[model samples]
Target: MPLTLLPTRASYGPGDPIGIELRGDPPAAAELSVWRLGELVHRQPLLAGAQQTLPELPAGGYGIELEAAGGTVARTAIEVTTDVRARLRYGFVASYRPGKDAAAVADFARRLHLNGIQFYDWAYRHADLLGGGEQYDDALGQPITLDSVRALVASLRAVGTASYGYAAVYAVGPEEWPAWQQHALLRPSGEPYALGDFLFIVDPAAPEWLEHFRDDLAASVAAVGFDGFHLDQYGYPKHAATLDGTPVDVAESFLTMLAGVRDRLPDARLIFNNVNDFPTWSSASAAQDAVYIEPWKPVLTLGALAEVATRARAASNGQPVVLAAYQHVYDQAPAEASDRATAFTMATLLSHGATQLLAGEHGKLLVDPYYVRNHEAEPRTLEFLTRWYDFAVEHDALLLDPAIVEVTASYVGDYNDDLDVAYQEVEVAEAAVPGTVWRRVTRAGDGLVVHLINLVGQGDALWDAPRNPLGKTGPGELRLKFVRGRMPRVRVADPDGRPRLEDVEVRIDGDHAVAILPALDIWQVVHVAL
Candidate 1:
């Protein structure tokens, strides 16, 4: 018999009671345990088919473990935070029909701890943010209705998920271009910049255009109850001209547009797509909830992925970051290998203190830029995804806290022997070197975090290629050189293989604290509390 235990929502506020759905039959020895970090704080007998409303938990990360026959049967995690904006776990959905299952979609997102969802292409047009009457086809020829959109908005909001309507900031439909031609952005060829004659671009900073955009956004919220807008743009034609031949710098215009958006919708949550890091340096500090980027082109390798994440976080001045990286690698390879690729990219983003806009309606994953072209995640992919998101939520203080600073180069590897690490079959490389283990170290609020990623047996550092799983491995090693007054208590977790945090024995040998790792999997986050 299969058994499952899932939280009713992604996250709970301080006053909300935690709800757990229990399915399948439970053995006589079944028990539910609650853990905070390395210590087990609560345990009680549990029955199958029971509606469990857990008492209020303290504000912190927790591991909810279900055990039977003296072994852990299932493990999951939950977060009770005072501020959900500490980390923005984003998801998206493009399907918006009247018959769609809005409740089920919200359930899937909440289970994965997705607190922010973008309704991709759920509008009548870029210029007309709301549909006429109740039913209409979106700009991309997708059939959507106001009923479904509002249903999803209400469902997601019930679980504390903010709904963002996807709004193309400049694109105007072909039929609407002529009426607004005077506001169109002209190229040097005396033609309005357009996308293959399907849609034309407009000057976002124009007074008339800005007023139209803001009014439509407000109407969308009033019509369908959207919490905010996902501002979009095509990453081309960096420079354009006004109809009267006035020079226009696209980046500066974007800054002006964002400021106006913030001023108009001061209470709503806003997120803009910084496509390929274009003008991110200038707009990172703009009026957006997070520094979101859609990476492409040269950002195909593992090192490149990490670099882009770092760049976005730095440019944003540490508010929050999101990567809309579509995993086309799944289409190139079978599910067997593609699962590893999915895990690798997720690890790279989460470790860099950024979330991903990948998950969508019904637990699907966004694998293409066209939001409608989502793909079903393999069983293995789903399993690891659940664990990783759970672990991240449980360790938000270390992973998403802006006060944390990465110090891999100065703390680990060759010459830097502060917290040295070693592995058998693989050697710790200086950087993200393919066919070798990648080691990283960060200083967080509660402790020092050391991240280890398994890059073994990989042909190259490219993130878009399939990879081998971490599989089973022998023990690894670690040694801390300088031991101060506080004898560090070591805690380790590999969300893929071990979602529960385990307290490892730290032997104090004179001035050093040493330990032996049972194994290293796809990724492991080790926290040493001083």
Candidate 2:
């Protein structure tokens, strides 16, 4: 018997529909069934030369089996990933160039355990790169070709990662300058404006201009094997002439483009870079897989990262939140201080469920040789990122799943405001829930997992609202609570490795358990199994 199924390797977010195709021998009279962990949930007739769509299923591993007149004809496994509704999957934005073969890039991705890769500096039209001065190849020194991109994407998928293409939609080729002159974002006098004499922005509303841009973008998608598009809009003011003629909102125009792309490639993921007015772009509720915000100007802090995560989640209706924070900013400080800050930023963001983390060189930002070479050859930076990658993989269940138990501890006030700073000194005798701190507790079968973070700089840190970040006050002893049905073995791991349970004390109450952590710098997790 010959049998086939559509999308042999299928993936779906929660609530997403899935189309299943089955083909086999005639008069086979097969009973098609789908099972979750061996429990039959779905059954249907098998029609020759026909296909059917399966009902929406929850996120889990499922098996599809077909029983025919002869016997069990075929069985296949299907996996449905979690929707990531309230969670995030941290990814790397820049191109993966390890100054060697493509395998080097794959190695870096594996080391980082990245889920997504944004191909850096790829453009289709002449104006997209170098403002029409010259059309050059990509960072690989070879001309950007469809085959190259396909190979690149295949490599990424080989390592269990997704790929996204980067493009500047509003940019125009120098050869198209005259056509875009009046349609470009202009100066005060309605004349074509220039950005440092090299780059110019096309009025997003211009009909003809929009068509040309869309055509180029569509072709790029077809030529490149990208899982999605990363629309980069360098936040700048609109030109009067272009603004007057165009009725579509600039942000809305981008959304329209995204919709068009989705229409063309239904399975592809979509993302945007909100450079300056990211908040405005984020608020639009456009259909996108994720939102990327630079957060460059406001100076990223633990509080700032948390706010972005919250806002992005709200704006996207719980889509993944991605922040492109510069790692070098933290690296410039004292070695230990810089490492702590970087780790703190990553931990805070992960705890809050931010999706992606971007690291770039600072000072003389080197892209050609130094940064790329170091990214592949340097051990220190790789080790730094490896720590984060390992943490993300180990606790993917808690990170991706909705919070079973959410707790907040107060240490510092809103770092964004000044008055909150003054309250830092007041040191209330009572403990308050800190805005930046987050603890997500989850249960796997009989095992309990907790993900915790301390975002504040001062105050006695607490396990269950005991001490502040400074280890000052609260319950001196640790507490543990249980479901009360059965007693379970318990183990704990710091940011490092697991310690002896004998040294740590744990107490259990009905349906709740708490562990008093020793004085620590960043975060800790406790695991309990019954």
The candidate that achieves the highest TM-score relative to the unseen native structure:
1
Q: Model 2: residues >4 Å from true position, as ranges?
A: 1-100, 124-135, 138-148, 173-175, 187-194, 238-248, 276-284, 330-337, 359-377, 402-492, 499-504, 508-514, 526-530
Model 1 alpha-carbon miss at residue 263, Å: 1.6
How many residue pairs in model 2 have overlapping backbones?
A: 32
lDDT of 1: 0.82
Considering summed lDDT, which 10 consecutive residues are worst modelled in model 1?
A: 468-477
- In candidate 1 the C-alpha lDDT for residue 521 amounts to 77
- Clash pairs, model 1 backbone: none
Candidate 2 structure quality by residue, lDDT tens digits, 1-530:
45644322224466666655554553456777776533477888875566556777777645556677786565444445764223334343333332324554554554454557666565544344323222345433444444545666776677556777777667654556766776677666665555555557775545676666556556666665677766676666532445465433466556666666556557667777776345344333766777667665564355566666656655655466677655553323443444555566666666666654554221111122112331222445445555555455445444434332233222123431211111122232212234333344445454555444544444422211222223322322223444456555555544433211223455654444444554333565555554
Candidates in order, TM-scores: namely: 0.95, 0.63
Candidate 2, RMSD to the unseen true structure: 12.7
How good is model 1 by TM-score? 0.95
TM-score of 2: 0.63
